[model samples]
Target: MNRRESLKDPDDLEFFDRIQKLHLSLDQEFLNQFQRSLPLNEVLIDRWERASRLGFGDQTSIYDSSLVLGNVQVGKSCWIGPFTVLDGSGGLSIGDHCTISAGVHIYSHDNVIQTLSSGRFPIDRNPTTIGRNVYIAPNVVIAKGVNIGDCCVVGVGSFVNKSFDSNKILVGQPAKCIGEVIVTDSSIDFKYF
Candidate 1:
């Protein structure tokens, strides 16, 4: 059902909406609990955080909001776009001063391979991690067993397979180094990463 019908529906949508609203309100409660978390009740915040985050704070964001991280630590002053999926199942970490564009998918496992091996089909996913000062464009797919170094840029619509060192601009399928990334007051250069 659409938003309008769902909002007006009485059977289940109403209940769903109520539950969602309550869940959202829990964030405020979480903040309050965090503030009130004493040495004696430090675990309270941790428990609340665990209960609230469904697989690492599934909050799609851009300018940083209430984040949920599971073995994944994101640094300060970064722009993570909406619908950006950062899975730390195998341990994902995002560094400071980065821009994760919209529709970016970073996987930790190779589902297609595991499907061909064992019985685990669609759910068998892997881990992925990204480093600091990175600029990942829209539609970038970072596959498993890959680590992107700091001060790098992944071009739009690129697919990464292997890991790379610092100071590079990656693009294309099975991404290759296009150039370096240089940022200045005048222009952002990709030839000097």
Candidate 2:
């Protein structure tokens, strides 16, 4: 028998079988609705359970493939998607109702100077904060010391290196304000520049 087969106890075998069944069901459902399959870990662990384990606020869900480092504080009703990195070695705070999309990386520290200086220079550390109701798109990177204000939408694949005010639509390499978000009771709109 194979090494894997020999190592499996009865309980382990049963658990693996259940996991396989769950994956199939979930994959079918996801394909029907979104034309995609659920990530393996997402099929195994409930998102809310993972969030609760990390002390995130109520109703926040962080994917199993996301990596969250030191001193990160996330508020309620936020969605942290798969393959993202939240580097909080210098402290990071994300406010309520935010969507940190897939492949996003937010850093609160960097070792560029240290590495270039052959360990003579110390790593840079700074706080990175994301305000309430922000939407950071897929593959975006937010650097250390950047504070994004409330209701901002960061476009996909953008690289944000500076702070931005509330209600801005930001995009591009060193993301620039390209539009504004207008919000009123029962209505919301985006006005592009």
Q: Pick the candidate with the highest TM-score.
A: 2
Q: Which stretches of candidate 1 lie over 4 Å from their true place?
A: 1-70, 120-127, 183-188
Query: If candidate 1 were superposed on the true structure by all CA atoms, what would the RMSD be?
Result: 9.5
Candidate 2, 1-193: lDDT as tens digits:
8634865598888887787788899878878976878877676678889998999999999989999999999999999999999999999999999999999999999999999999999999999999999999999999999999999999999999999999999999999999999999999999999
- Assess the local accuracy of residue 29 in candidate 2 as a C-alpha lDDT between 0 and 100: 80
- Candidate 1 on 1-193: residue-level lDDT in tens? 6664646557577777775566556655756865532222322234324323433233322422223334555666666665567666666777777788878877765557557867655645445668888989998988876888888989999999999988898989979997887767798766632
TM-score of each prediction? 0.60, 0.86
